[model samples]
Target: MSAVLEKATFSKEAYKEAAGRLFHNEREQGYKPVGLHLYRLPTGPILYARVRMHKPAAEGVYEKLIRPFFHDGIEWKRGEPKQDNGKLLYGLADVQNLPQALVIVGEGEQKADELTKIGAGRLAGVTSGSASSASHADWSPLAGRHVLLWPDFDEPGSKYVDAIAAKLQVLGCALQRVDVAALDLPHKGDVMDWAERFRAAHDRTPTADDVLALPMTKAVPLDPPIGDPAEIDVWPAPQLLSAMTAPLDYPIESLPPRLRAAVEEVHRFVQAPLALVASTAVAALSLAIQAHVDVKRAERLTGPVGLFMLTIADSGERKSTCDTFFTRAIRDYEAEQAVDGKFVIDNYQADLAAWEANYNGVKEKIKSTAKAGKQSTTDLREELRDLEHDKPVQPKVPRLVYADVTPEALAFSLYKQWPSGGVVSAEAGIVFGSHGMGADSVMRNLATLNQLWDGNSLTIDRRTSDSYTVRGARLTVALQVQAATLRSFFDRSGALARGTGFLARFLIAWPQSTQGYRLFKDAPDDWPHLDAFNQRIADILRLPIPTDEGGNLVPVMLPLSPEAKDAWTKFHDEVEVSLRTGGELCDVRDVASKSADNAARLAALFHMFSGDTGPIAVDALENASSIAAWHLSESKRFFSELAVPEDVVHAGRLDAWLIEHCSATGAPSVSRRDAQRLGPVRKREPLAEALQVLEDLGRLRVEQMGKQITVNPALLEGVAL
Candidate 1:
């Protein structure tokens, strides 16, 4: 379609030498010597030639093509208009010129010319590009014409045949494919190979009549014939299910040294679950310090360092032990505060009573003096004003953590306390199966959590008198649920969670169970890591909490160092790439899209936890990026499992059952009737549906002749299930 086709001219002999005998013969017929450059050696001499061909439908419409030499291992290249060459066919002008000719369609320009010389009417090369590109070719030129297709004998050739056949059937052409397998040919052999073998045996090229006489198969249309639908097999196309596997390993090394050492010690006792719970506890600790720390990504983009984390593992994984070990300092601090808070609360109460008594006495005196019509009641009124001005203020207790509370109550605590709170628990059902997570309140709870994660205010308006607003609140939450419970959460809230961006805001981990591996081990004489870990947490708790002029808690911004900012920017940009179409996060883009923001928050948290009150360092951001990378991988795996269609999941379950129940010998077949009677599947419709899916997936095949299902032998190859 360009004004002029651009090509590097090469020597005729050079073209013949590079392209070999097949192309040499084709060149003699009509192939021209136009060349292209090879990859990597851009300045080198031309490596191949472009074969110009005209469109059958129009004149002066030629497609640019490049056929490279195999010696150089260079793939065929195309010019600008060649990405989707659907409208153009090779040798199209020749085929269009021949009316009522029995067109022999094959792959390559050389083969088409070979067939053309053998008296095959209007020989046409399929410019559909490649085996994978077959479906994109223009098959309309052969519409209503009798066409014979000779696909190369290979797996890709079979796909090539299927693609062309599907298009031909739609175009309503008279079609048949040469059964290359029936004829003895080499692996990945072609139509020319068959002809050459015949020539070698008979001392002459095979004619059109002889080639037509060979066994051929008719094309099968995708749609069933208009008759009894029961006669046709109803198989749904198989969707590619994500590989069933555990989430990526938790990033224990990403933790700061003291924390990492402490996690390693705890992991010796509880294994990977310890790392998961510890990571979550760290996130909770970040939330407690959220009001006192923030990451300045840019002038317009400063964010809280809080994190919401969820860990999923089966019970008896010592999830509680891991939580208790990391959270001991927080609990001890809360206890200490409770002890100190009681006396302060009592003193304030007693002072409030005395102040009220004094104010009442002053007010009574002012009223009596006014009623008696006495001179100058201004002195008594000024005393009442003084009493009112001296009214006692209630003391605020510094409480840091919350457990098993509804979202409404959580918001109230945030408002009444330091505008910072955390929900820390080993049981996830408290969050997922709570009354607040019911149908009516699910969105409200999820929305509230999402706001808190963003460091935004939550306004809880209710018909009851307990309505309140929590402004500038920071919330950190961590929960560990069983796999079954997690699945239930997905079932109940997955769509809503994704729609409201609730799931995206949380860092999630689903670690492999390490139940049997744990053994009794004595601690080292100086296990200072655990002490240092708790001590660091206590130190963070004791940092003078930043507050506004009105005594309201405010976030203390923690800007990144120049080195950390540069590293974080690069990491953030890399994460942004995955959110694009066809990337790893394409399916779970809802969560994947938020990965970088989560990384930024994590980097700041890591810096603060490392005892750095200054700017965030490069090492801290690097470690946080490592942790974020793990979470992103786990999120992709987790969501892929969650995204598996209901029917596909049923098919997978049935697949496992079939693999389990099959007889030792490969001869046994299960009857559909008997399967319904004795199989793991109870419902006929769903069982039939699942079986149809498994058949489509090549896991098994069903035949009406036997009314039985035979599992594919390949399904048992090197696999127990």
Candidate 2:
């Protein structure tokens, strides 16, 4: 019993091979129904068998039945085992040509035998579980002097034979089809079913005439040629001999017109490769942006956070094809929908269409139906203005305020809403900041993105083409989440600007691939800040940190007093008027000079504080120290260190030098009084105060390129020489 079982199990490998053949051929067409199982092979080989689950049985039973042919050479693709009778599907092997030509045209072991009886070599059959378009290609190298194409006797079978015939013709083989008529003569079924039919007929000889006809298919006739396909790329060849057969003395300008045209054509063909080379180089370089990229004299900027939104969309398609696009769209849809829904609830309360349909009803109700009386939209909007959100005033919600925004600016439109859970949306709050309002949606999104970030760091075994690898985690989830998108956008295109503001503050880029270039086309936020975000990436990616003037930090002062704001606005207005009126009278050079002066004035204001000239001038000293360090002509290492803002330091050694020639009791220098600690003169005026401080300390804030300096007394406070 054991020997018989071993032999039977050893032979099962052919069946497993047939299953694998069916799998690879079929799975490519998408239906992958089979699992895997360890099965016995005909060579006493224990191997993985890809089986389709056709009947229900205990899971591990098939492995037990086929365990007898165990061996070591066969590799396994370890997968889930099929149950029941283990209807094998595909095999577990890297597809290759078998040693012997096991020409399998599938049915079962019996049908394969029938095929062998006629023209037997190593005849076999792989099941029709998958699309067999691959049979011709995969079997080509294996098709020795013998080749067969036997399929189920049907229309599909005929087409299969025809396809194989055309395909084999390329390999110098005439395909033969397996017709089933001869196999049916045995009994009621095919060649494999010949056992029952053998009992009906007195025929033991397995030489069936029609069985041989199965392996035959003629080549398809070619279409009559109109022109060769090569005509598309055809070019003229070299002329070995001229009409004279000897080298003619070619004239500088006397060549015949037809021959010249031919020569010109030849010249063009000759230069084509060179042109292609130059074109490719130009294309590669064009993607790199070239511009006058000095940011405020090359200062490293770390300003307020700038946000960018990119909507990756196809011009004509209904939806995007990016991975996880649907989920992204759903979020976008929900956000935009929330905005729209809020507008409706606040303004219409009831649907506009429904109201319009009942416009007569509203008017009718104004007289007969109920409370309040309003008709026109102007009045309707005003009436609903008070009823924006849920009433009865829920606690903790901040009241919103509104302002009319135009195409150029973000509208500061605010309204009051009861608590939607103490949500203090900066956008919905009273400070709907200038054009800065639109970034609110993306901001709220980012504040929540940290939750989705997984803390894994991936260590790649091999280097791939992709540059940014997110530790061990996938950026896909982060990208799909709220903040990753905006973060990526700003990091990409923030360097590009329309004037100073980014186009994205007004528009969005493509959502999925808003990487480097895609983010740049148009931006609407703070372009400098957008560009600044990329500096953070240099550290993360281990590349050199890109410095703008070596990371210059710009400190902008805000107006603490209403008067300063008013003064600023007026000054700005006057500057604008001066430029517009004076510009017309001057030549282009004169106009440019005036513009430069205006720019200087604006820069001054941009760096000013509301504390009059005192603090602004003192702060100006710190600025001058930094400015001097950045230049080629006035670079100073010690002065550069003065830019560092700190709490406290040394003083005794510097103090001794300040009060030289002073007597201990009531001491007075030749020109000044000596005190234990004498602070610099507070000149009250901006420039004077600035200079006195700088004289005592080591740095000064020079306003214009070569103007008077604003100095800080604090730098000299605790300094030791």
Candidate 3:
């Protein structure tokens, strides 16, 4: 005997007891009682057995129970298995021989078995375990086949069929819905019920022709109903992208003591979004300390401590105020340095003038000696070479902040003027909308910034101007702009911004506006926290910048402690899993790929800014990981929103409106005319486009009957129609 038969034995006494408890009139029911049923693979080996009862042991309990079995080479070994890809639909093997035949999907295994017996060679039948299991089962066998959904006469059954339809649609199946209402069956009826009624009236079992003759409606195709199909065919529905709700608030507690106090104080004084204040303050801190150290994440992985932050908000939100407040100390340090270096500047000018005069005199002597053909011109050439070598070198001044500058100009400044600086702007239009980001210069400038972010050397080769190479340079870019301007930038840049990973390097925040809730109050009596914060910034700025003799930044390397390294490794592996094909972060893989690195950089900044000594600690890495994870989620939300077409966004809005409207009024659908006048999208053309998008997504169906719009059963699964 097979292993299945050897393990499972028929229970005659249990069958008798179940029949007595379940059926009242066994003789008149006209069907023999069978207690044991085997669930097998399509190739004919039993996988498991289910013992059936005529009714449940108690109300609200299952009528069938599964018997455990051992299965080698599968995730499921014994007991109830998970309803995943390992579990195939019943009757799947029977349809493999008939590749082009029609398949009927029903609710349970019993119903599927009856249909398969009656289908003979004409059709096949299958069920994904139960109504709710449709999403979990492997549906690849039904790909490219004709599928007819025969749901029960109730709402849950309808939802089950719709769920199956969704999977089948993705598999490229030709779909149709069987109209159970036309059969005039009672509530919660099934095909088995109809067969029993037929036996009562005609004294015989119903044939396959009787069930095939039932009514059904074909699903609408991908083409829109009215326009030329080619017009909309070019735009297919996006894969694995969905609308997201607002992200959680920024984790203010993650910052160190001094930084947290400053952020809280600024938020109180400015009454802006807490996130805006925190992000600006973090960027300013990065600017002050990035040139001092490089964070070592692993043996071979080391990167700069610089950060690129972008904040999106509307006008009148105090973005400028927040930026000015955080950067006040850096600006003050620049002014103080310029005042203290006046004498040095004057001496350099005098030295440069004297050197220029000596260089010209030597060139004249060389020319005259060559013209006279005297002394072979060797001594004069040597004098000119020495003069060239002793040219006056300009002093390095402290000019660390810039705004409204082109990328080329920024590169030049970093190369020739200073090795570390920032481009801080409240109105980001001066940066994103400037000529530097125009069609011709956008790519080159983006690459330049990306190179700086990675701490790699940048070589700027200019044809009409001076050529310079920037090594070990660091930059912190913090910008706040309105949403409309950012969207316009995305439109102009096409795919270059995200395609080249320029935007991926940025930590973005799009916080909800806190406008009307700002009820003004008197300022605090003493600004002790803000005062201390400014003092720390000034002290860090006054520290000597680590640099080589060639004027290139050479920063101290900060390694992670053993515990910190273990924590970071776990975080990195978790993010890596989410970058797989169907994971949540799959669409935004670029941003997720860099999140761990950013976490390490943030940890270094916290370590240096808090005046901590030695290696990075576990607490610092934990705090930084929390903040970095929040920004990663924000990236997923905004990037997905930015990539969606305008019409599809409108469709998402309409979908919400429909759900509310249908649930409030207890209606299955709304008329097109009413939707036009009373919907979220009022204009006719836009509404039409939005509706077509919804239809293509299987969220709703448009019927010619009064041009009515009926939502898919899956949308309002539990609610009454």
Candidate 4:
């Protein structure tokens, strides 16, 4: 009870000092402090130190304050305190009582404290925690004494003496010398041993010489050190040199007269990006001509330098000028450009929606017509006319046909899986369409281009000039260095373009054209400027585009799942039970047998149709469906799946989800139930279990009247599904 009262008598701020002398080194007397712990705060990145920590205290007050930090990015792996052997000890004395210019200088608090045993009346020590150096007291009276640096015989002891003396000398205290080997202590014992020995041997205060002659004793240093070896050993970076060479390594080839002037003009700006240089020359030349509004200027006419030249260009004189420039002069430096047809094809892909629609619609029509009885050549011709005119085109059913438009369907399927869509050639603008496709890919593919439409027929919905120009970098040398990178790339490829993927064989145009090049280069400026240039170029050179516009994608074409089919049958019979007929709002209090499952499907289906950022966004699933909402939802699903990839049983569930939703939404445009019923399919037991899982996720509500499925629409993004 008295100890408790005494403990409570301490001031809050003075707890550290009072606790130190009583708790420290008193371990030999009992109640030896064993452990310590630190707590970290998140908001301020604050650290709180706790002394005398045991498992219970560490886990109680300390743990409660710091444990929550772990969830806020703090690490819990930093556990347990080290045992500080008796080598460490502490002391607390009124600093105002000490005298100046009086005693020994040492590094550690423990060693400095041993000065008291040597019979010094005005001894002072650095009061700090274990293994720490350098501290100060607010009112130390021992500020001006001659300090004797009595370090041990070892290297560290010698270093400590040197450091301590240096600081004491600066403080106007004379450095008293002490020989390391004669300090009369244990072989490797520190200042504490010397103090103990001196106390036992002498009855009064010891002089500098007496202390100096004592025996070898190791101790910590009182001052900061000199130049660190690590810092001194750091090396500087090597310098790059520019020297005059013996001769130019580039080939000096003869130039044809017609290409000579143009080549030289381009050469002047070649130090910049080719696109920027070309555009600058064009703009300057256009001013010189003063009457040009279109890309068909007389001065712009040129020829193919190689198949790679076309690969790098979309329209206008880039191809022709580059070709003529390269072939007309060996010095033309086309080798320097190193444009490959394949690179261009990889970068610039075509939209194949029109081709895919035509293929799919025709294939299905042909099959349906043949089954119903017949198809004529007139029908085929009519279909061809409609295709050219952006109208629906039905395939002709051959009298001897076993399949309808199977080959065309194969081509359509081949295109969807194309990793990098388009041809690898310059001569014919890098063919990217199809004339044939393998039979194996029909079910997997969605679209293909039928032919290379006439260049004059190219069109975009907006005003022309879809081409974006990438201005060259302003740094002349850097631009040249970047240009040289292309040559190195080509040289590494053994001076030949690479392969186009498996689709090349299907496209007849790919064989005749050179392939492997990037059609667009990086802009010297920002994206906005590049976008502006693209708009300008697109206006100047519009290429023919073939697409299907009217026959929009069926966004909600869901697969017929057994459970979903059954639910739809019941929901249709009792539609009024959950929703009012033809009303937008619903009182969905009751539903049964996988209705919550249907709700999950709705959410996913809507996410798919919503236009959102995700891997599936590349598919433009929402845009094609003209339903951005579902696409957005699919994107959400894609990301949520990132944390739990195995959540979806299979990809086919995406299709099944869509089917269930359209049935529930009761959209007028959607088709009704199947005529050929496979009635009452088996209920999925695992799926029932899956419902519990989703319910746990708060994705389903099973209270009140019955099970209620709620779709959190906010999670869905992009176009409606």
lDDT of 1 at 621: 87
Per-residue lDDT over 375-461 for candidate 1, one digit per residue giving the tens place of the 0 to 100 score: 778988888888777888777777767778998788887787657778887887887888888878889888888888887767888
lDDT of 3 by residue, 1-721 (tens): 2343334333445434433433323323342344444455665555454444343446664333322222222111222223323345777776776566578899877787778777776667788655545654677878888888899999878877766766677788888888999988999999789878888998987777877788887753534332233421112211111453335668788999999998999898789989889999999899999989999999999999999999887676787888787888999998988988888889999999999998888888878878887567787778888888988788878888998998789878888878899989888989989988998889999999999899999999989987889899899999888766888898889999889999999998988666645789788888788888888988999999999989899999999999999989988999999898867688889999989999999999999889999999999999999899989988887887776776875676677677667876778689988776666566787788988888876567777863788875434432445
Report the C-alpha lDDT of model 2 over 1-721, residue by residue, as the tens digit.
Answer: 1242333332355646645543443344343433334332334344434344322235643211111112112211222122122222222121122344434443332344345444344343333222222231233433343455555554444444454455445665544545555555432244455434544574654444434434344333434321233421111111111011101111212222222232233223222222111111111111110000111211232111111212222121111122111122223333554575675565554554455545544454445423443333555444444434323322212211112332111111111231000111112112222233244343422322211111122222325533221221111110111222333344433332222232212111122111111222232334232123222222222222132342221223222134333443343344344335433212122222222222222223223211133222323222322221111111111112122221111121112233322322222222222111232221234324333333443323334543433222212211111
TM-scores, each model vs. reference: 0.57, 0.24, 0.60, 0.21
Worst 10 residues of 2 by lDDT: 286-295
TM-score of 4: 0.21
Query: Residue 387 of model 1: what lDDT?
Result: 77
What are the runs in model 2 whose C-alpha is more than 4 Å off?
1-98, 106-121, 124-139, 143-145, 185-445, 448-721
* lDDT, model 2, position 563: 38
Considering every candidate listed, which one attains the maximal TM-score? 3
Candidate 4 local lDDT, 245-319, one digit each (tens)? 011111112211222234345444223224323322222121111111111101332111000011122233233
RMSD of 4: 31.9
